[model samples]
Target: MLSGLLMIVDMQNDFVTKNGSLYFPQAEKVKPVVIDIVKDRMKREYDLIFTKDWHDPNDLEFKRFPVHCIKETYGAEIFDDLKFIIRDYSKINFVMKKRFSAFYGTNFDDILKNLSPKHVEICGVDTNICVMYTVEELKNRDYDVVIYENGVASYDEKLHEFAISQMRDVLGAKIEKWRSFNAQH
Candidate 1:
């Protein structure tokens, strides 16, 4: 039985690619690592779940950050490289989120409940923001959350490290390098 879920958070063009409006410097570098993790997990008893920031044109979040990931726009789409691997949406679930945390204003909680995963591994961009919030929420829901250190990135290096530490120490999440985690699974 598939009791593990791999959550790829905000690996969309706006956060992970150069052409995006809110692209992070190290975001592109984590792509290959995230892809490798995905491929490896696909070969295991783990299901894939991708979360994208599908914001409304007039979303309130625009006041905090630059306008990006507007619905139906290229910025909101998943990176081209990752899109190819999603050959079947039925097997790979996609969750469109409007806020920083995937659990807010989305059916993410319901989906997580339905899947009933024993563990959830998270990977993606802006480690200090979206990824951090998601981790906090997942932990609050009592899920065993694992963060792939090498597969996630942040524009600010210090904040990235801090977020990882917070998730590991405060939220009680397991932090591991993608290669190390993949090797075990």
Candidate 2:
């Protein structure tokens, strides 16, 4: 049986690039960590997944957040640095999410049912929002979740730290440094 699943969440151009509508500077630093996690997961032969924030032009989420990552646009595409890597990897489950939680309006549950991974490891953007919400849902579903601390960041430093703590304490997800996973495998 496969021991783990690696989920790269919301690592889209809109969240990672400087000129994006909702650009956060910390996202640049987190990109390399996310890339490293992807490479490690590739070597480990675990089920790999990516969650994209594929919003519509009139998405209701635009009321609270800035309009970004519209479907079929460059902003909705994966960050350039990671795109080629994912492209080269043949087995990737791409989940297009309309909401903060990937499982809310997508085929994520079906994919999980098929893979049946022993644990899920997550890494991606907006530690306080999409990442946090997805982690919560995974925990609710009783999946053993491990979040890569160095691979997650948000626009607000306070909220990022708060979300990390909340996931660790309240959600019961394991929070570990990304380097440790590489060292182990």
Candidate 3:
């Protein structure tokens, strides 16, 4: 069993629900897939980490969008059943990242070092920004990044497609789909 961490990024209500500050159609579509990945990934005993975009309702970050994903609100909560699905009695490092990079302002790097992960599979919402940003961070540190394309959800199909391309072309990461990864990796 190779040491690996599944980075589930910003698949919360603020980005999934229609009323979200920056909702994307594909994100909602991929919600079930993300949950399934989390469930299955946990059974493998691999490190499961989620990067939440818990923003202040009136933060300047929302100036581009609006107030959403405030703490304890529906938007802030992980997508439905995502909570019930992953049985974590042991506070499994669910960090809240204020910026696009999960590495910033959080103990993400420290946690990964503890896990000592050799490979990272990043899946979540907002493809172009957070996903791309985090992938680059991991690459800079020479981590093998496996990006689950369908496992991630994004706003704007153009951005989503281009994001994947960017990872493959620029980052030298493996690009795979959810179904492909589900086929007994």
Candidate 4:
């Protein structure tokens, strides 16, 4: 078994809250599980990170979603209920993101490289998009990866299931539940 980090995706207010333009209530629904996972990781002395969508309201992405994550905006912060204890600031780096994919134009990869965790357990919003890209990047780099199915939520169940299914069969990732951490694959 390899050491791991919980790479939480963008669970920001803009894309998740009901009042936000690109709301995904489902995203809010699975948040507790994600938080629980982080809490568990902390107990194991593993890294726990959250990716923030720190964007300009005027950016191109707003043209498509109409929601924003501008700096200092309520929409830019992590969801209120999902906040977990910070075991160590060094292990819990928050990557500010401008686009849907947290990897682009961000030192997210560098942070992960520094941590050198062999397995990355990803969870959070938009399973078919950001989550998929993150896992793909990790796979390309030959990093061990797993996705906690119960720890994430998406706008559509089909896309969510399809994305994980494809990742499992094609990307060679292991898809399991939030509590799956306690068991061996």
Q: How much does each candidate deviate from the true structure in C-alpha RMSD?
A: 1.9, 1.5, 2.2, 2.9
- The per-prediction tally of clashing pairs is 0, 0, 0, 0
Error of 4 at 174 (Å): 1.0
Candidate with maximal lDDT = 2
Q: Give the per-residue lDDT digits (tens) of candidate 3, residues 1-185.
A: 35878888987877887777667677767887787777777877778888888777677787776776787678887776787777653536788877889898889889888888889988887889989999989999999999988888677888889999999999998998777336766
Tens digits of per-residue lDDT, candidate 1, 58-154, equal 9998998999999899999989988987665455788898888998888888888888899999999889999999999999989999998999999
Off by over 4 Å in 3: 89-91, 180-185
Compute each candidate's TM-score over C-alphas: 0.94, 0.96, 0.90, 0.88
Per-residue lDDT of model 4, residues 62-124, tens digit only: 667765778788888787766534533456878887766667899988887788888888888
Name the TM-score of candidate 1.
Answer: 0.94
TM-score (C-alpha, index-matched) for candidate 3: 0.90
Task: Tell me, by TM-score, which candidate is best.
Answer: 2
Q: In angstroms, give how far residue 100 of model 1 lies from its true place.
A: 0.8
How high is the CA lDDT of each candidate model?
A: 0.88, 0.91, 0.81, 0.78
lDDT computed for candidate 1: 0.88
Q: lDDT score of model 3?
A: 0.81
lDDT score of residue 136 within candidate 3: 89
Task: Report the backbone clash tally of model 3.
Answer: 0
The alpha-carbon lDDT assigned to residue 71 of candidate 2 equals 96
lDDT of 2 by residue, 159-185 (tens): 999999999999999999878444766
lDDT of 2 at 144: 95
